[model samples]
Target chain A: MSCIIERLAIVGVGLIGGSFARALRQAGAVRHVVGIGRSRANLEHALSQGIVDEISFNATEGVAGAQLVFISIPVCSISAMVGAIAPSLAPGCIVTDGGSVKAEIVRECEKLIPEGCHFVGGHPIAGTENSGASASFATLYQGKRCILTPTERTDREAYETVARLWRVAGANVCSMDPERHDRILAEISHLPHAVAYALVHAVGTADAEGENVLSYSAGGFRDFTRIASSDPVMWRDIALMNRRALLASIDGFSASLAELRRRIDSGDSPGLAEFFTIAKQFRDGIL
Target chain B: MSCIIERLAIVGVGLIGGSFARALRQAGAVRHVVGIGRSRANLEHALSQGIVDEISFNATEGVAGAQLVFISIPVCSISAMVGAIAPSLAPGCIVTDGGSVKAEIVRECEKLIPEGCHFVGGHPIAGTENSGASASFATLYQGKRCILTPTERTDREAYETVARLWRVAGANVCSMDPERHDRILAEISHLPHAVAYALVHAVGTADAEGENVLSYSAGGFRDFTRIASSDPVMWRDIALMNRRALLASIDGFSASLAELRRRIDSGDSPGLAEFFTIAKQFRDGIL
Candidate 1:
């Protein structure tokens, strides 16, 4: 479908936000794109790079005439942004977010949202290490999955509108329970970051040999370092917000680790072999 | 030096071994590169692809008159091959290996080594998921470190020869104690593999809703799965042979994981923030 929406407004002109605008426009999914952000420089940059047809620092004016509004701010600011634009949303406008955590965002917005506006939670699982408008490319969302978590109060029309937009941008849309989404991602995404960060410290910390360990950290440690190099503030907020689920994943990992330790201490070669072999089987199934 | 060595022998035609041959040939490090393997098809393929100047299925025949011998077979088979070649190695021949663990191979070879053949354990800190000769690339060693663990018994001339050859092939060479090498790599390399495998199986062994969890395994779970997709036999042998150091690394990781769990359970916001912030600092040091 060409020009599924007449206007698409993206609030936050960072990597994810700029990428969505660029991809939609290049794919002909939206006729006109509007960019909104707290940073005047970012908005100007987005407009100059053709990521948006219009630029507005004022949140209300940005969404005034838009059919689709995407709140692409960091997780910590999702609630405030939802509240800021809730009062001025165009009639029957659809609102979705690209935040990592959904339950909290959904819960905060559900109670204060304006009537007739659909608030469907969305997270497009497409990104790169680079950030900002210059780093964004038009094909960033091709073949990636976008998850839509709609609540009971969410309008069906709003959900479909967001799904259609994602589909036109070359994303496969899937539905999930918000709570389950948070928990599953805690194990897969958040825990890896936490573990990688800890491992980085463990290697770089004050070993008697100084940076000898860190100097030789290129083996497998380099990969861990990249994941650990993510934005500190973003990861800090994720760990604090998803504390419960992150804890559950850590517990599961600890139990598995403890079992390994017991076998090692007892010199159980057969047991260790069995454990590693089974683990190999499970990972093999994924690929 | 346009060409340093007149002849070089690589004992296995796997990714690392084949890549070493390719890089050496591409850089004119060695004039004649010989590949030795048990698989007839692999030996023929290596010859046809110009990965080696010659192919020999017999270990003794492979090392005869060769100035440099590289043992690139699996860890378990390292000792037997060393024994087979020790009796036939040319006088003043220098030998090195691409194995992950250093101490075991050093210990096994030190017992049966003949005079004038020196064993300097080497670990090239590079590779990909793909294996075998066809997957080999010439730039595999570019900008990577190659750690050499040489004991007091190692001949100075032999050590320098190995270092110079690795340097010629585009690797930064450094020296470390074999025992220390095992411990350091256990944390940076071995334990990560173990944890990746365990995380995969941990999700698999979860309760009745495990299928749903597996389906959503694309996020960061895919990263763990990618690492765990490593050769099962190779990993199993590593876990079994390097039992002492691998287990110790697991203990260290377990402690860190437990601390994360405790902070999450108690809702210790400061603790979580401090932990993540400290990790960020360490990760930044690497970059």
Candidate 2:
């Protein structure tokens, strides 16, 4: 496993990509890392921090001759970035991503990738509300789950190579169908973000004697809405790319909430108690 | 503030009551604390830990000759417990609480207390998801906000006395109308709890290729659902007492969620970004 990757190209060198580069560097698993991003200041900072061996504003030039390319950016832009840099990828180069939604992105990447190259959809189920290269650390992915979504046509050798990188970064890699990954993430991750953001919005706008409700928030309120402070553009793209599943999740949550409201409105004490009891049990069951 | 309270009676003796007694004792503000609750095991544990000077199961006997009484039980039982202890309270005894919902509890307790004894509705805006005497700590209320809700009929001297106790425990005390407190709490605290519980229930029950979504939850999911593990019976009582305001909050949250759904469903990227941007700003505004 000594320098298994000769050269690695990281597009959108933000939190996810910078962390991947740093983790791989720390493990001595990757050599000659090329960081490509829209932010010159960020790329320079990453270079100064020794997170990347080289930097480029042009994805095509950056990815040229790279054995592996990791696309970590907004979900909406991943496919276009892949398309823009496709011709520059080496014949045996494998491309993967750190995108949240997988189905559409994987489909689009598969369609755009060169015939001899490969595309794998990967999502590391790890992050804080903070984003950017400055917010990343070498241990960000330690013991975290990284789900790789591969369709039937995906090249097995390329998939294994990509999985090795995540494994080397201390992540436990698992596989799921592209669509299944999208659906699960929509429920497990996207819906919770939406719920948090909406709760904050509703509470912030609520008035009590003209006092904003959020001003008096305590620890519980702050913890519940912590995810609401995440990168808005990244989440917006995630919501759109995973629209149908997210919509369904929202409906499911709305129904659950409506049932709670009904029980409370009807003064059904037993029913309310039962709902909260089940919720508590289920919440406690999450690892 | 040397032993301002000669004897303090505490009902429920759970996290809130136990913490109150411990904090008061730490401040040397209460000479003796009588811990009253339905659970003999918990009462004995509280007494053993010196959280309460004595333990009692009889509410009437618990408050006899006590200068201050703090009821920190489930909201639904606050009035009945106050009634049972009302005749036993000495003249000028001040009865307060750590209930989340205030208007209804205050009204009910104000009616049940004896003439010489005063009822002051107070809510210490602090707690953990854990409950019972074991979860209590001496500094639980330090630097926390304690909102005292008093009506026009509330005794000024009794209210001041209760405020002094909270201040001695290192709490910043403020006064508000009972109904206003209920509305504000419903939006700030109750709604977030409801959202967390509903989100967890919805995700835990969701199927992804026959897999449970909660199994793959990350740190964000765990943080978002932490409040859902709060005491079920306690939340059930709060939900019932704060029914009207919580119902409105549910509707408000539903509307906010609907707007997000509309933006995502319509593929309005700018709108979705704006929505998330505003939410992030608002959430960041909270301490």
Please report the candidate that would top lDDT against the real structure. Answer: 2
User: Could you estimate the TM-score for every candidate?
Assistant: 0.89, 0.98
Chain A only TM-scores, each candidate in turn: 0.93, 0.98
TM-score of chain A of 1: 0.93
lDDT string for model 2 (A71-102, tens) is 99999999999999998899989999999999
lDDT of 1 by residue, A141-175 (tens): 78888888887888888899889878877889998
Q: What interface RMSD does every candidate have?
A: 2.5, 0.8
User: How well does chain B match by TM-score in each candidate?
Assistant: 0.94, 0.98
Question: What residue pairs are clashing in model 2?
Answer: none
Give the lDDT of residue A162 in candidate 1.
87
